[model samples]
Target: MLLPIFHFSAAAIDAYVFWYDQNYVDLPFKNPMVKELPLKSRCMFLTIWCLILQIAYHTVAFLNDVFGTNAASPKKKPTIRLIKDVLFSVAFPIAMYVSGAFWGIYAVDKDLIFPEHIAKLYPVWVNHVLHTTVAIFMFIELLTTNRNYPSRKVGLSVMSVFIGAYISWYLTVYFKTGTWAYPLFDELNWPLRIMFLLFSYLLVIAIYIFAEKLNYVTGSSKVEKNLSGKHKKR
Candidate 1:
């Protein structure tokens, strides 16, 4: 319960900061991306929402354990566990990896990735707080807490939907505004854009496989149990 509250607060704070800091321009009504920045700008917001969902289920399960009540249903536990795994293993990694790449590019040549004006709004620490700290915090959680991952098929399917949906959303934003949401999309030609998207998805899939191996090698099998009614807490 307490941990969930902390995650919720942190995510909410980041959202607030982005909006408040980017308030210089009065966005046009036509561009939905500018109007709904948090929803369309980055996949980080989506991952944070996933984290909130994961924590909500975890809170319920924890309460049930403490109260000795079967409040957290068996069916719901599996679904939530699967979502948690997909978001942490797939979504979080994608956001971290993509952000790191662009942040590096921006460091080399700021104009190539982030425009001078936009770059000024986000200080170095702010960038780290938004992009870097999220993965670090979740990774620490994964290492300390027991987590049961869904099967590879389910994990891949879920992550596919997530990445596909974001692509569609960006396409919609482009159609509406006649511009791309992120600078990287603007910088790349159509062929390069398609290749980048494909590469990103493939990278996420590879990371998913790596996470499975890491979980096994770290003996999470002994610490975390599947949601099929066999769960142990250390």
Candidate 2:
């Protein structure tokens, strides 16, 4: 019951926010993170990608709970399960990384990621919506759903590739467009930029490993209580 409600709300909220984002238009703020420099240019941020994944994950979870529930399990449609797992794998860690990195940098230097003038272009709460709530929903899914986390080697490899791809993309965009995708890059010299990208890679990889173990211990077992009322693991 709660799971269904949560999923519905999450999906609806993400969809609404995503739609609003697509529709809103703004002047170029010179801050790459700000939406609507050209308007559609905001799509390039990794944060946007994570938001898209969150929307997909929650929509599927909502459908699974509403139509695929059974006495044995509340939500376990096989196809939906596979998608849910795959999205969760990429989405959760990426969400954590984006939220963590954004706030972490915002704390240290607002100009580095989100400049002061960027605040005027968008509402404060919108910042929370983009950077905070998505991760919160992913964390809830972790607690509420039964999941099969990929083995560490596979998980780490996949995340490494995912992180590598983004690094390549931002670098490519910078070289091609003469623009840095995020403001952090503008502050760094080449050596520091290299270190920053390396740190980003390690951070996402660590997030994947930690989340897998956390899920195994507290979230992914497939057992329930018996007639004696003792909980057991399967």
Candidate 3:
């Protein structure tokens, strides 16, 4: 259903993105602030990683829905469920953060995140696909499915590691390329940089907490509690 469609669309659009990277010519926009925010090391961008996870999560979900069907066709196989939950934990928060942060900065000053010239030079669809659609599908999936969210401690720990890894990655990218992945980082001084990084970590942590609480409010916690009670009785 929605799972298969998400999988196919993400995959197809991603392929086009790569092709666009190669086949398309350079953009007209020119600015030190914009630098190459360029297509190279596109994988180094969280947006790309989120899209990859989108493809991965939906592929797994689709297979679990299709091939895993039986008497409990509706109930996911234990292994598939575990993998899907892990991807869900990793994918959803990061996707939301990318969209929220990107658009917020874009709204404030397109120069800090996405330069206005790029939007004018290239198709607007590319920007929305990378920044908007990823989160939209995540929201749709959140409403459409019931997931066994991990415990708060486990979920937050993994998010910490994931964010830490990305921080390390972009630092490495900056050192190697002499350019920050996003212009927002380039615009900040040392004290402001530290404050901004700290703020970002706190913001993402808040987002993760909100999403976990949301899953609980949406009824996943009830099912989890029932399972816990059943296990305790046994």
Candidate 4:
């Protein structure tokens, strides 16, 4: 299970690197290690990030259950409390789906829009299905947990960070190699590219907000928060 997952993730990382090298307009870092690491180790790194998030989520919840206090409270177990602090106070918003959806859409469209040269190695439907499935699960979990709540500020901040990082990284590539990712963005006139970026960001934000609202209406908010506390703490 781990090996196949690792392989798939490695393939995904390779695809991203290929796209970045080909389409990135600016190259940020000249360090060979930085360029090579993502190509060779991004899969393992991302997988580790995911596993850490999962573990932290479960650990915090467990601690909360045992202590009968919110992890946010300073009086709780310091280690568990710190993890909860980071998970809820930092990573949650960052990991939220609002901005991620834009990349998800782009990943799908890159294949369809430029079928002639791109060869569409990965199936678009698979990307959509997998993303949607994981998103739904995350939503369900959030809704079921009592502490979960939608914050526009948090969502917006996350979106901003994602876009800023993506642009900055690509800009570095562009400067170094004069390339951009996803030719659709480069092929478009500047005006169209800007419009697309804005539209995708707005659409993703709206979708995420709507999902949060749905969770609220369905009374998943409390459940999700509670579960988060229970499952996320160690």
lDDT by residue (118-190, candidate 3, tens digit) is 5664577777777888888777666555676677788888888988987887777677667676778887887
lDDT for each residue of candidate 1 in 1-234, tens digit (9 for 90 to 100): 433454455556555545554564333335554566553344333333444334443444343334432222243454445445445555445555555656676678777665767566666765565556655655544543345566778877877887787678767767765766566677789999999878877877777777667765675433333322354332
By summed lDDT, the worst window of 10 consecutive residues in model 3 runs over 225-234
Q: Arrange candidates by TM-score, descending.
A: 2, 3, 1, 4
- Comparing 2 with 4 on TM-score, the higher-scoring candidate is 2
Against the true structure, candidate 2 reaches a TM-score of: 0.83
Q: List candidate 3 segments past 4 Å from native.
A: 1-3, 14-19, 22-39, 69-77, 219-234
Residue 225 shift from truth in candidate 3, angstroms: 21
TM match of model 3 to true structure:
0.77
On lDDT, the stronger of 3 and 4 is 3
Output the lDDT of residue 56, model 2: 84
After superposition, candidate 2 runs with Cα above 4 Å error: 27-39, 67-77, 219-234
Higher-TM-score candidate of 1 and 4: 1
lDDT of each: 0.55, 0.72, 0.68, 0.44
Candidate 2, 223: how far from true, in Å? 12
TM-score (C-alpha, index-matched) for candidate 4: 0.49
- Tens digits of per-residue lDDT for model 4 on 60-134? 545544553442223434554444433443333333442264355556784523343433433454333223333
The lDDT, on a scale of 0 to 1, for candidate 3 is 0.68
